[model samples]
Target: MIVVTTPTGRIGRHVLGHVLDGAEKVRVIVRDPERLPAPVRERVDVVRGSHDDPGVVAEALAGAGSVFWLIPPNPRAQSVQDHVIDFVRPLCTAIGDHGVERVVAVSTLGRGITRNAGLVSATYAMDDLIESTGVHYRSLCPPAFMENLLSQVETIRSRGTFFAPISADRRFLTCAVRDIAATAAALLLDGSWTGQDSVPIVGPDLLSYEEMAQIMTEVLQRPVRFQQISGEAFTAALRRAGVSEAWAGGGAAIMAATDRGTYVAEAGSPGPTAPTSFRQWCEEVLEPAVG
Candidate 1:
């Protein structure tokens, strides 16, 4: 049996779709079952409760051989550390007690760095907690998600511009969430070998915001430019979008880190290579936005 948390999310949904055909016993932990798509809700066993609920975790883990775990960020969280610890502690204990052997956790590339990557600090702590349980664990340390680029679609359509704190020419590693989900699904289904492993999933190529803008414009057949914004402006924009101050500050910190090259993965790291490119993603996913 395999249990998935955050099954409605981007990566989780992909993971679920990848495994649903092969696995006979697949379950999803969802807070509200009614919110699930009809096909998804009908196909899997739905455990109606929060992943952080001990009883729910135990139930979800019962007789499960593998689990795909992802901790969603709480934008309203007062302190990031406190929110993460509170959420992970119980799930770790439940996994330990419930005899679930293998876990694939979604994390980010800059989690190990101490100076920057403020929000990723929580994922690093989660990796530690999951490792302590003596379960076979794989922590996926992926670079910037290409899906984040979707946020700019409306702006590009209306204003012919994508705004970000990242410099237009600053090259960075970015991977599609689909690739991350595929990697996690492969590990869960195979379950061949794992003790404690951190895989830095990188895209086939490194790209800059300017290059991305060009690709978007070509794919969408519209003129789009990358507009770099100040850190203060970025934070204010996030706050205006109703994101909490802590989350906005953390986002600003991450952008600053990106500017300093802290988010770039080391060359030749031992991890899976994702085949998707920014241009391909734009053609397949982002082009639909303008339609």
Candidate 2:
């Protein structure tokens, strides 16, 4: 049996779909089984609770061979590092107790390219803790999610503008969440790989906000503009959007790092690059969100 965590989340749902179709006996640890689609609920064994719980994880991992892992964001937690560590410790214990064969997890870029990046640093630390458990692991490290652009749909539709902390001239790296899920599903279905490693799931395009604005304009058939905001302003915006101060500050710090070119999309990633281009993502994801 294969176990999946966060099965109703964006990437998790997609991973579950692939696993279910692959005809693997699938089990999922979810807080609310009702959130799962009717078909999904009927198809898999469900442990109804958050994966961070020791009992919940132990129950889910029982008799499971491979696991798809993802730590859902806890923006309101007091400290990002503590939140992730608290969530991971139980999984570490469970992994050993259950003797899970292989694990795949969602992670971020800039492992060695940059240091002291708030959220990035915390997530890297989370990966380190999981790897120390000696479970065969694959950390799917991707740049900022292209889906983040979904948040700007209203602004793009109304004012023809969107905001970012990065400067217009700086080329930013991004990854489609679809690619992340696809890669994770591929890993989980296959049983051949061993040892520990990281896969960079960055998309092929390297774009500046200005260039992205141009593409959005062309794709949407409406004028669009890039508006660069200060780190403080971005942090405040995130705080207003209900991100905890610490995490919002970390997000701002990450933006500052990216703005400075700390992760230039090609620094530490030497593995498989995702096939989706920014334009394709915009056409497929952003345009639909805008509509």
Off by over 4 Å in 2: 266-272
Q: In angstroms, give how far residue 19 of model 1 lies from its true place.
A: 1.0
Model 2, 150-175: lDDT tens per residue?
87889999999999888998987888
Please list the C-alpha lDDT of all candidates, in the order they appear.
0.83, 0.88
Relative to the true structure, candidate 2 reaches a TM of 0.96
59-113: candidate 1 lDDT, tens digit per residue: 8888888999998877777777777777688778887788888999898886556
Candidate 2, residue 116: how far the Cα is off, in Å: 1.6
**Candidate 2: global Cα-lDDT?**
0.88
TM-score of 1: 0.94
Could you tell me how far off, in angstroms, the CA of residue 259 lies in candidate 1 after the best superposition? 1.4
- TM-scores for every predicted model: 0.94, 0.96
Clashing pairs in 1: none
- Lowest lDDT sum, 10 consecutive residues, model 2, at 263-272
Query: Which 10-residue window of candidate 1 scores lowest in summed lDDT?
Result: 263-272
